[model samples]
Target: MAIGGVTIFATLGYFALYSNKKPEASAKDVAKVTAGVAKPGNTRPR
Candidate 1:
């Protein structure tokens, strides 16, 4: 039971830390980040 709880906590913690806060982006936004350029709404990956 302790191990199961720890596993669940770890999974949730990882997602909270590394999950993409942006679920959707405009084409212009996608283009900028991958091209190593910055657009108005593009954010670098955390």
Candidate 2:
């Protein structure tokens, strides 16, 4: 019983440390993707 509890705790700890829920993205990146401002070889100040 004790070993089982320890294994469960270790698994939880590993998941808590390694899991990535939200990715990092800047506002500009999001905005650019949302608005069809420019395509390849095109640049615009928005």
Candidate 3:
């Protein structure tokens, strides 16, 4: 029972630290795609 509890907490902690973090390359790729589809006048300023 103690081992199971520890395992569960470890899993939760791992996800808490890493779940919302994305790769830098992936973020840049998404930005490029979004900019590609955006209208010329509606784009964000750099």
**Top candidate, metric lDDT:** 1
Global lDDT of model 1:
0.56
Ranking by TM-score: 3, 2, 1
**Best model number under TM-score:** 3
lDDT of 3 by residue, 1-46 (tens): 9999988876665455344434432443344443455343333334
Q: 1-46 in candidate 1: lDDT tens per residue?
A: 9999988876665455345446564544554554556655466433
lDDT value, residue 36 of candidate 1: 51
Query: Which residue pairs collide in model 1, if any?
Result: none
Candidate 2 CA-lDDT value: 0.48
Angstrom error of the Cα, residue 9, model 3: value is 0.1
TM-scores for all predictions: 0.41, 0.41, 0.43
For model 2, what is the error of residue 2's alpha carbon versus the real structure, in angstroms, after optimal superposition? 0.1
Q: In angstroms, give how far residue 16 of model 3 lies from its true place.
A: 0.6
lDDT tens readout by residue for model 2, 1-46? 9999988876665455335222453444444443545364333233
